[model samples]
Target: MTMQDSTDLPRDTSRVDSLEDKSLLLVDDDQPFLNRLGRAMERRGFEVRTASSVGEGLAEVRRAAPAFAVVDLRLEDGTGLDVVQALHGAREDARAVMLTGYGNITTAVAAVKLGAVDYLAKPADADDVEAALLARPDALPEPPENPMSADRVRWEHIQRVYELCGRNVSETARRLNMHRRTLQRILAKRSPR
Candidate 1:
């Protein structure tokens, strides 16, 4: 089509709208993940702000409630749900998403009740976050392009428990109901690809 015809043909100007107020708050205790996600979101047209703890996230919310948020379930100081709640309290129109490495039914339900638009497991990519933030109320999100493999999920679970138990092999093994030696062996191996 000619340039003038192309201009007349309806153009998707979603990215152009990024110049508008698309402030986003991201809270996670994981330093690397937080930084990476922040940069990715910025590239996707969001004015990204980040915090590493519940306290920081609350402070950011108090300063100004963002249009969107992605918060971790557990923080060093408190639960990320606190941030989500505060954001909703500040701005009723804010859309929030909860993130967790340790996902469970109760917490997911709680996130929804607290006004979160969606709940996502840890290791979620930038695309997933963007889709959730901008999704229409009546639309369902598309599935992830690359979901975690079963082995990877198992590995992540073991790793989370191991960290939660303060890296005490015996305790993690006991909690997981696996033999200490087996737990040790799994820990020793590299995470599945």
Candidate 2:
């Protein structure tokens, strides 16, 4: 089913009051990640409502009329691209931030064309997300000149897959079409503090 089909679900209203007059809707399939990120946003003076699916997130947006939204590109049931469209439909002034572990030029460009204010790769710290949200209209950070580098593109690919799979080596390897051992070896070579 399409992401649009998923936005018809009910939502929670408990934390709506705490969102500092600036409402935010956060959508991700990872529940734990959502909890942590939602709390961080709330602490930063945003009223945060979270959903694990695109459908529920959209419902929250309709209910809360948030000023901003942070959406994951890939949800468990649908993609966040549809969420971007829905948010824009709800509030023309609303800013949407696309968060994903699948970082690519095509997707980034599509996000912008689809109305996202910014696109961020996964594992992005809360501060980074906040900074992007607070950036002025003309001050949005530019995307990397060239996101793909020959020498390190493979490493980046692995990292993105790993993050998208929630750090599960097996899932990452499967998605990358590589053997688990190879993925582990690559990860092992990285410097550790």
Candidate 3:
């Protein structure tokens, strides 16, 4: 069983609607992540609406532009930069922050060129995201306080490759040049610190 085993609970939107300049759009392919982050942002005074794909995110933006956005760089269907561009087209003043488990220099630069205000590596908290989204354009956001453990970086890289290979263990092993059983063991274990 998972945290999302029950999806019948209703989300309360009344209090969310009453807050102005606090509307947010959160886009990620991971449903549990979107749900958890949505609630967290709401706790910090944001009226949160979430989407799990670039198409859905674009649709949501067309329906209603948000004051802020936290977008996952890689969606199941397409890149989150598409959503950022759409949001900027709808409302140029909207602030957007990009998140990725596979953060790279090229993608970060592309995201910025597409109008995202900031790029963040994943496992980021709502506070970090909020700060980036709300920070002044001229100011540089503070660097990450803690360095990622080498094992954690390896775990994140493996996960990213696994996802890219459509979760196929054999394909991921081939790409990573590891034996199939070794890849399986890594995938089954909890993420390293």
Pairs that clash in candidate 2: 6-55, 7-55, 19-46, 19-47
Ranking of all predicted structures according to lDDT, beginning with the best and ending with the worst: 1, 3, 2
**Can you tell me which runs of candidate 1 are displaced by over 4 Å?**
1-19, 143-193
Candidate 2, residue 48: how far the Cα is off, in Å: 0.6
For residues 29-140, write the lDDT of model 2, one tens digit per residue.
9888899999998898887888889889878877866788899999988889988888888888788899998676557777888888888988777887877666666653
RMSD of each: 6.1, 14.5, 13.1
> Which ten-residue region of model 2 has the weakest summed lDDT?
11-20
Candidate 3 positional error at 14, Å: 31
Assess each prediction's global lDDT (C-alpha) against the native. 0.87, 0.79, 0.85
Model 1 agreement with the true structure over 1-193: per-residue lDDT tens digits: 6457665787543322343579999999999999999999989888989999999999999998999999999999999989999999999989999999876555777899999999988789998788778777666556766777899879878887897799999999999999999999999998775
Best by TM-score: 1
Q: Pick the candidate with the highest lDDT.
A: 1
Q: Cα deviation of 193 in candidate 3 (Å)?
A: 12
Candidate 1 local Cα displacement, residue 115, angstroms: 0.8
- The better-scoring model by TM-score among 2 and 3 is 3
- Give per-residue CA lDDT, model 3, range 79-158, as digits (tens): 99999999999999898999999766557877888889888998899878877876766665566688668988888788
- True-vs-predicted CA distance for residue 115, candidate 3, Å: 0.5
Model 1: number of clashes? 0
